[model samples]
Target: MSEPETRVASPPPAASVKVLSGVWRGLGPIVYALVAGGVLLLLMGRDPIGFYATTIESGLLSQTGLEQSIIRMAPLLLMSAGLIVAFQAGLWNIGGDGQFLIAAAVVAGLGAPLVGVLPYSLALALLCVIGFVAGAAWTIVPSVLKAWYGVNEIITTLMVGFIGIRLANLLIKGPFLSDRSLVPQTDVIPFKYLLPYLPGTRIHLGIVVALAVLAAVHYMQTRTSYGLSLRMLGASPKAAAHAGLDVKRDIVTAFGLSGGLIGLAAAVEVLGVWGYVRADWNPAFGLTLFALVFLARLNVKLVIPLVGFFAVLSIGGHEAARRAGLPNDFLLLLIGLILFFMVFTEWARTKGWTAGMRLRAAGRTSQREAALDE
Candidate 1:
C-alpha cells in the first residue's frame, strides 16, 4: 500500500492581529490628544496627575457618581441613535436640539391636562406618541425639500431648529406657563405620570427604554434588508437607484425616524427625570451627542459605551476643574483638542501618505532587482 499522504493544516488567518492593529490605529489620535492636553495642563501650572485622579474618583469610584453618570448617558444614547440613522442615510439632521425642545413642549403642554382625564397608561402612551409625531412633523418639510427639490438640508434643518426653539419658548411662556410659578415652564405632570426610579438611586426607567431602542436599532441595521438598502444609498444614491432602491423614500424615512427618536428622548427626559419642560432650561446636549456619535465612528453598538464615557468625562472634568481651580470651560478645550486631532488623523488616512511611501519604496526595490538581473 502507498504511504498515506500527510498534509499539515495551515495556521488560521491572523484576524485577531488585524483587529488589534485597527484598534491601535484608531486610538493613536486619542493618545496624542491626551499627551498634548497633559502638556498644556503642565504649562498652565495645573497638576495633571491629581486632576485625573480626582476625576476618576468622583466620576467612577463613588456610588452616587456612578449613578449620575449612568443617568446622564440615557438622553445622549437616545440622541446618538437618531443621529446614526440620519447619518447612515447621508442626511445631516442638525436640528436635533430643536426636535428635542419641540417634543418636550408637546409632552408638557398635553401631558398635564390628559394625565387625570385618561387612564394613566393610556395617557403616558399618548404623550409619547404625540412627542414622536411632533418631532417628525417638524422635520417633514426639510425632508421633503431635501428629497425632491435637492435643497441643502444642513441649512434648512438648522434654520428650522431655531424656529422650533422659538416656538417652544413661546409655548412655555404662554399657554403652558404654570400658574404656581414665575418661571416660563409648563405645570408639572401628575405624580402618576412620572417615571419610577430604581431603589436608592436617581437612575430611572428611561435608561431601560433607551437600551430597548438601541437593541431594536442594532437589529434593524444589522439584520434587515432595509438596512442594506440604506447603506447602499449612503454609499452612492445613483448606484442605489440603479439597483432598484427607492432612494427618495429612504431619505425621507430616515429623517422621520431620526426625528422620532429625538422626540422619544425628550419624552423620556421629561417624564422620567424632570416631569416638566422649562423655556430657559435648554440642555444643548445635541452637540455633545453629535460628538459622541462621531467619536464612536457611527456604530450603534459603540454609542452606548462612548456615551457612558462621555458622561464620565463631563462629570469628572467638572470635579477636576473645581479641584484645579481652572475655569469650567477648561475641559471644553481638551475636548476640542481631541476632536481636532481626530479630524487630522482622518484626513491623513484619506490621503494615504504612508501607503504612498510604501508603494514608492517597493518600486525602488523592483528597479534594483531588475538592475541586478541585467
Candidate 2:
C-alpha cells in the first residue's frame, strides 16, 4: 500500500496578512471604545445591557424604529458619499452643514412654486439640479483659493461653511420666508409633492437616491481614471503634479463634487421629510461623518454598515440616553472615544509597540517552557 501523501499548509501571503492586520487595526479601536463606554455606563449606575438592548430593540427590531432609522440614514448616507469623495481626493468639505442648509433653502424656496407650475417629476429634477449647483457654487471661493493660491482648504472651507449657514438663515428669513406660517422657514411643499414612499414602506425615495449615489461613487472610485488621479493626488500632491496631472483643476473639481453631493443630501432631506427649510435647523452630520469615514478607513464598502450603525445610534441613542438619564450628546462622546482610540492604536502600530508587546509575550511563554524542561 502506498503511504499517504504528506501535506503541509503554506503560510498566508504577506499581502493577505497585511490586509488582515489592517482590518484588525481598524476594528480593534471600535471594540475598545465600546468596552470603555460600557464601563462608563456602569460607573454612572446605568445598565449597559439595558441600554444596548433598548438601542437594538428600538432601532432595529421595531418597525416604526426601523423606518425612522432608515429615514435618518438617507441624508447621512449622502453626506458620507460626499466625504468619501473629498477624503479620497485629499480634500475636506467640513462645511457640509452650510452646504446642506443652503441646498435645502434653495429647494424649499423654489420647490412649491415649481410643483405648482411644472410636472412633479420635472420639478423634482430641477430642484435637485438647483441644489447641487448651489452647493457646488458655495465652494467656489475655497476651491479657488486652494487650487490657485495654495491656501489651506481646512480654514477656507470652514469659514465658507459658516458663511453658508448664515447666508441660508438670511435667505430663509428674508427672501424665502413663507407667509403661511409664523416660523422662519421657506414655503412648504405639500406632502403630495414630496418624494414618493417606497412600496409597502414609509421610507421615501431618498434612501434609494442615497444608495444609488453610493454605488456610483464606489464605481467611480474603483473603476475610473479620475478616481486614480484623485487617489494619487491624495497620496501626494507633489507627486501627482510631477506626473503631469492637472493639480489645480483636480483640486477645484474635487471641492465642487464634494460640496455638490452634500447639497444634494440637503435637497433630499427637504424633499423627503421637512418639505421646508427652517432657520437654525442643522443636523450637523459633517463632523460626525468625519469620524465615521475615518473609522471605515475611507473604504466605500465599509461606509455602508458604519452609516447604518450610526443611523441606528442617532435614532435609538436618544431614547437610550433619556432612559439612562443621560444627555443627547452622550452618543457624540462615544464617537469621540472611538476616534481617539483609532488614532492611538494607529500611533502604537506605527511605533511597533504592539509588535514589541507580542514579542515580549512570546518570549515569556518560551522561557516558561524552557524552565519546565530543565
Candidate 3:
C-alpha cells in the first residue's frame, strides 16, 4: 500500500493576518487607556466603575444623551473626513482649528444678512460655498510654501492657524459683531431658517452632510487613479517623482481638499446648531482629532465608530464628571493617555516586538495543526 499522505497545514492568510493586526492596533490603545484611567481614578480616591457606569447610562442609554452625542458627531465626522485626505497625502494640516473658526466667523457674518436678501435655502448654500472658499483661502500661503519651496508645513500651518484664530476673533469683535447684543458674537440666523431636524428627532441634517462627505472621500481614496498617485506620493515622494507624478499639484490639491472640508464642517455647525459664531469659541477639535486620525489608521469607515465613541464621551462624561466631583477636563486626560499608549504601540511595532510575536504565534499554530494531521 502507498504510504499515507500527510497533510501539512498552512499559516493564516496574509490578508487575515493584516486585518487582525489592524484591529489590535486600533483597539489596544483603548484597552490600555481604560486600565490607566481606572488607576488614575483610584489614585484620586474615586470610584472608577461608578464613574464609567454613570457615563454610559447618561451618555448612551438616555435618549437625550444619545441625541446630543449624535449632534456632536456632526462636526467631528466632517473634520475627520478632511484629515483623512490630508494624512493620506502625507501632509499635515494642523490648522484645522483656525480653518474651522475663520470659516464659521465668515459664515455667521454673512448668513444672517444674506438670508434677508435671498431665500433662506439659497443663502444657506451660498454660505457653505463661502465657508469652503474662506477655509481654502486661509491655507494659500502654507500650501504654496509646502508645494514649491519645500518649507515644513507643520510650522507654517501652525503659524497660519494662530493668525487665523486671531483674525476670527477680530471678525467677531469688529465686522461680525451683532448689534442685537453686547456679547462678542454675530447676529443669529432666524430659527425658521436654520437647518431642519429629522422627522420626530432632534438630530439635524448636518450628520447626513458629514456622512456624504465621508463616503465621497472613501470613494475618492479607493476608486480613482488620482488617489493612487496620492497614496504613492505618501508612501515615497521620491518614488512618486520618479514615476513622473506632478508632486506639487498633488500637495496643493490635498491641502485645498482638506481645508475645504474643514470649512464645510464649520458651515454646518453654524447653520444647523449655533446659527452664530462667538468670539474665542474655538472648540479646538483639531488637537484631539489629530491624534484620533492616527488611531483610526486613517480609515474612513473606522473613523465613524471612533468619532461616535468620542462624542459619547464628551456628552456623557460631562454628567459623570459633575456627579463624581471630577474636573470636566478629565476626559482630555483620558484622551491624552490613549494617545500615549498609541505611540507606545507604534514604537513597539517599529522595534518588531509586535510583528515578531504575531508571526511566531501564527507559525506555532500552523505547526500544531500539521502535527495533528500527521
Candidate 4:
C-alpha cells in the first residue's frame, strides 16, 4: 500500500457560536434588570409601559434630547475607556472624578489665557496635551506608591480626588475669578474658542475625539504586544514577572495612561462646552464616570454603549422628575436599584447550580477516574 502516506488537518471549529453565546450570556443580566425595572414601576403606581416608553422617546428619540445625550456621552466614554485600562492592569483608579476635575482646571488655567493670543485650534491642542500631562502627574503619586511601597490604590486614588476638587475650587474662586463676574467662575473663553458642533446636534468635536480614543484603546488591547503584556500583568502579576515582562513599567503606564485620558475628559468639558472654569460646574463627574466604568464590566469597548444607555437614563430621569411630579431622589433610588440588581444578576450567573466552571472540572475528574478504574 506504499505506506498510504498522507496526513489531514481537521477544519477549525466555528467560533461564531461561542462569540454569540458569550454576548448573550453577558446580556442576560441586562434583560433581567429591565424586567425588574418594569415590575418596580408597576408597583410605584405608574403604568410601566406608558411611562417607560415616554421616558425613552423623550430622552433619546427626539433630536434635541438626543443631542444632549451625545454631549454628555463624550466624557463618560473617555473616562470609562481610561478606567478600563486601569482595571485591566489590576489597578483601581477610583479617583477618576478628581482626576477629571483637575484636568479641567489645567485647561481653564491655560486655555483661557491663550484665547486671543494663539489660534483657537492651537490653544485647544495645547489644552488637551497639557491636561493629559497633568493627569499623568497626578496619577504618578499613587502609581509610585503602589509599585514601590505596596500602598492600597483604592484609598490613595479616592483621597486624591478630594485634593483635586479643592484645587479646582481654589482656581475658580480665588485665582481665576473675573472681576466683572459675580458668580464663582473664571472669565469666559471667547465664543470662537468653543468646539464646533456636529451638524444638527449640540454634540461637539470632543465626542469625535472620545470615539477616536476608544478605537485606539480597543486596537491596542486586541492587537498590540504592549496591550497583551498589560492584560497578562493584570491577570497574574507573578506570572508576568516569570515571563520577564516589565511589571513596574506596565503598571505605571496603565495607571498613568488611564489618568491622562480621564484628564482629557475634563479638558474637553472646559474648552468644548463650559468656555470657562466654574467652581460649581460639576458636583461630581468623577463619581458618575466611575459608575459607568463599573457598569461596563471593565471592557473598554462595551463601555461606550453602556455610557450611552446611562446617559439616556440621566435625561429621562431628569425629565420624568420635572414633568411627572416624581421626586428626583426617587429616580436616583431607581437607578441605584437597577445597578444593584444588574450586579447581583451577574454574580448569580457565575455562581449557578454546581457553579459552571467548578462542575466542568468535577465532571472531568470523575470521567478520568472511571477510565482509570476500567
Give the per-residue Cα lDDT of candidate 3 at 267: 92
lDDT of 1 by residue, 18-86 (tens): 455456444655567777887889999988878878877888888878887888777778888889988
Please write out the lDDT profile of model 2 over residues 1-374, one tens digit for every residue.
Answer: 14323322432234444565666676777778878998999999999889888888888778998999999988898889988898898987788788888888888998888888999889998898899889888989999999999999889889989999999999999988999888788898999999999999999999999999999999998999999999999999999999999999999998889889999999899999989988988888889999999999899888888889888987888889888889988789889999999899889977878743454545555545544564
- Across residues 1-374, which tens digit of lDDT does each residue of candidate 4 receive? 23323312332222454455456444555555666766877787776677667668877998878887888888778888888889888899988877888888768877778877887788789889988887877898889888888799999998887787788778778777777677877888887788888787678888999999999998898899999998998899999999999888888999999999988888887777788877866646566566656666777767887788878877776776566567655545555655676677567767763233344455556545544564
The alpha-carbon lDDT assigned to residue 277 of candidate 1 equals: 90
Which ranges in model 1 have alpha carbons more than 4 Å from their true place? 1-13, 190-192, 350-374
Candidate 2: RMSD to truth: 4.7
- Candidate number that wins on TM-score, 1 or 4: 1
User: Which stretches in model 3 have alpha-carbon errors above 4 Å?
Assistant: 1-9, 13-21, 350-367
If the candidates were sorted by their lDDT against the true structure, best first, what order would they fall in?
3, 2, 1, 4
| Better TM-score candidate (2, 3) | 3
Q: Compute the lDDT of residue 185 as modeled in candidate 4.
A: 78
Per-residue lDDT for 1-374 in model 3, tens only?
14434433554445566677777888889878978998999899999999888888888999999999999999999999988898898998999999999999999999988988988678888988899888888888999999999999999999999999999999999988998988889999888888889899999888998999899999999999888888888899899999999999999988988988999999999999998988999999999998788889899999999999899988999999999898889888888999999999899988878853576578668656655676
Candidate achieving the largest TM-score: 3
TM-score of 4: 0.84
Go through the candidates in order and give each one's C-alpha lDDT.
Answer: 0.80, 0.86, 0.88, 0.76
Per-candidate clashes come to: 0, 0, 0, 1
* Residue-level lDDT for 2 in candidate 3: 48
Candidate 4: segments with Cα more than 4 A from true spot: 1-21, 329-335, 353-374
